[model samples]
Target: MKGSRRAVVLGLVLTLAGCRKGKEEAPAPLPPTPAEAPAPGAPPSQQQALPPDMRRALSSIAPLVESVKAAVVNVEVRDAAPSHQDTPWNGEGPDSPFGEESPFGAPFDGPREDAPRQGLGSGFVVDARGLVLTNNHVVEGATRIRVQFPDGKEMDAKVLGRDPLTDVAVLKLQGDVKGLPVVRLGDSDAMRVGDWVVAIGNPFGLASSVSLGIVSAKARDIQAGPFDDFLQTDAAINPGNSGGPLFNLHGEVVGINTAIAGQGSGIGFAVPSSLVKELLPQLEKQGSVTRGWLGVAVQELTPDLGSALGVPTGKGAVVTEVNEGTPAAEAGLKPDDVIVSAGGHPIASGHALTRTIALEAPGSTLPLTLYREGKKQEVVVTLGTRPDLEGVASREPSPEQEESPQQRVGLSLSDMDSRLARAQGLPRAGALVTEVVPGSNAERAGLVPGMVVVEAAGETVRRASDLARVVRDAPPGDALLLRVAVPGGGRVLRALTVPKQ
Candidate 1:
């Protein structure tokens, strides 16, 4: 059965090739008495020829492919593999949620300790002066790097700059780097779904392989990084295709092929060219990117949450917590403020706000429109340099020595005294939740033990009675909005539905 299938597929390919050849304007003359040639004026066999309409639709993109193939190159790197002791797993098992491998390539096998690990990936020239663009993972921690063009010419290269957050890297070729072929970057924002695109790369070490497909989706968050706005494509991106170009029909590079779905075929992702364009200047000059910061944690305001907060649904991001001594706090931006716009751009979600802030320069003052307490207000804030969040750790709360009677909402609350405050790494105020009943309103609202209730119904809750009083005064079936101080340094809002007595 397999052999028969292969024969059928091979025959189809040859038929397509023949159709393409027949469409060419210039044709080679054939011998007058050639054998196996179809007679003139005779209808072509249905099994051997495609319909006219189908052949036209499959018109060759040879001219478009030829224009951009020269800029594409193969990237080779050699780095030392880490030993088991140096691995980040730290005794975690495969079932752990963070144990999944990166989608860019196959998982690294355990090699001999400090062994040289050789890798292959694809890249393209973006400037005539030998500047190349590729994925940061391609040459990360490499002891040696080489760039090989489609013509088999090799040149040593060095990392100009790299941004791991977006998985983009820029390289500079060594030696005489004059008049190199470059690809023109296109606007990824303009590429719509189902638009034709071509991919050129060295998949699996096969140099200069080409594949064709369309944009499958946009703005996909695959959890690859904090800034994970990837362009999903049906193009055949594989292990060695990382950092290659995804070109549009006009021969303009739209995206850099980055990763692929491990268990699925025809599902791949690329970094949009628009984002790469924004980083090119800094990557070339400063050798790194400096992102502006607004020290605040935010959450997406769903329709129900928006109606409860008296704001438009799906319009803005809700500020969950404002860090102390930060630009947000200095500008009087408080928790529960809905950010509707920033710097004249409308903020649609938390991710949008984050990306906007990160794109701005540090120390740049920007205007922000916010909805606070059902009143619209505008504030100007000076951005700060983003701080490293990797070192921030959440402390576990100690066991509570006393327990209160369960409330109607299924929460046992107590006052946050000095002992509990120090243990939980929180301030000495608010009502602390000692217990939460399973399958109850509080649990359904995400109320868990160790969470401190800072405010209830827009009022401060310094003790258990303060929270109970607000809950009691609320009408049945109404959601009691509560601001909670989580175990970490951030705060979150939860709405618990009042039970009918």
Candidate 2:
């Protein structure tokens, strides 16, 4: 009985699943009507569904892509290990820059013969004179560099100069070739998000590979460095795509493919070639690029900070610290001031401030509008050479730092040393409290990280051991007074009375 019931249920289920209604299928289709179509050789009705902007964009860009491909060349770099043990820096003997302890200081594994190691990149001829622009990282350490044309013809190239901070480099061929198809540079500032862009590069050793996509974003700060105004595009830039041209719809070079977001798809960044055009002349004229430096550490203005500074829109970069005797400080700039404008351009963020300052020529005077302590002040600052980038900043500490003590109250101290203070964006020389042990006397006294211990027991603290020595020689049962500058403000803290040992 159970088996029969199960069979009936299964049959019901199948019948329901496959059920078709009982219906008649008796109808004849009607013939075509003349009203629905144009009568007697008239033109058919036009459809208006296509977007006009898209059509215009496609029509304008089609020819430009092909034109751009003609000038974009593949770059091949060879980093051949020397036949003998070569130092890293000089590329010569063991005592070379790489040092004797360098892992790559040894020779190659195969026959002790010289072989040209190879790497592939992409670049476009910017001038008929054989001037090409590429990423600095592409050929910086290369031993031999070669540029290959679309016809498979190759020429040896020499580096004109390179700026690592911007990752821009210029290369020139040995001989000038006539009728060279040079790519015209476009204004990247005019680019808008979602605009179509094409990238041509040698991705994974595939030379002259073209990929298409739209500008995903603009002025993207990937936190690569100080000069990080990058154009983020999704045009399939990959490894070996570095140093290639990112072209706009008119076949104008807009950006240089410098980096791709790691381990990701459809995310890449390019350095705007407009910067290349701006900096190339300087690179060619001089051996290095010199940028204007403000010598102030700036912080982005958040909503709360803007409110505190009375900026309703939260615009501008706030000067958090100013280096003494530097351009900003010499111009009477101070901490707690907001840089609302530089060189007449509005300061939007820290990056914008850097970019604006960089655009100014070294030794030129730049007018800065600053908001300080509730008032707008204008100052003309003579720009200084970007010390670090140009290797102008004194790398060594001043003579005063050598006389500073080492230890203080379970904390390591150094002279609010020049190098340390400059690197840390501190204004004056004070005791730099390096480390305070957990549960140590200094830590218990509310001495936190980055505190410049200025005073101990009303005596000036010039070094780390100043605090330690003062505390050691202090009269028992007396509170230790410490003056330190916090991130937001400065305060004097009284350490709890400690019995002398």
Residue-level lDDT tens digits of model 1 in 1-501: 000000000000012233444457634434433334456667665223322334324457776777778888888765433321222212134542224544655432323333344567888999989999988767665545679898878888988987777778899998888878898888999989977787888777778888888889998866666577888888777778888888887778888887777667888888899999999999999877888999999988788778888885567889999999999999999999999899999998888898889889999999999888878899999999887553211111122322122434657788888887877687688988877765556789999989998998889988888987787678756898899998755799999887542
**TM match of model 1 to true structure:** 0.65
What local distance difference test score does each model get? 0.73, 0.65
Clashing pairs in 1: none
Q: Model 2 — which ten-residue stretch has the worst lDDT?
A: 3-12
Worst 10 residues of 1 by lDDT: 3-12
lDDT of 1 at 184: 82
Candidate 1 CA-lDDT value: 0.73
Query: Could you tell me every candidate's TM-score relative to the true structure?
Result: 0.65, 0.61
Please estimate how well model 2 matches the true structure, expressed as its whole-model Cα lDDT: 0.65
TM-score of candidate 2 versus the correct structure, residues matched by position: 0.61
lDDT for each residue of candidate 2 in 1-501, tens digit (9 for 90 to 100): 000000000000011111235674533434434434345554546522323223223433334556667777777654433232221111233333223221111222222243323356677888999888887656554545678887787777877877766767789887658788888888889989987788877776676677888888999875555687888888776666778888876677888887664435787778887788889998777745789988989889898998887765588899999998889989999888888888888889978999889878989999999888778889999999887743322321232332111112334566666665666666365677666544444567777667787777778877766766776566644777777755434555657344322
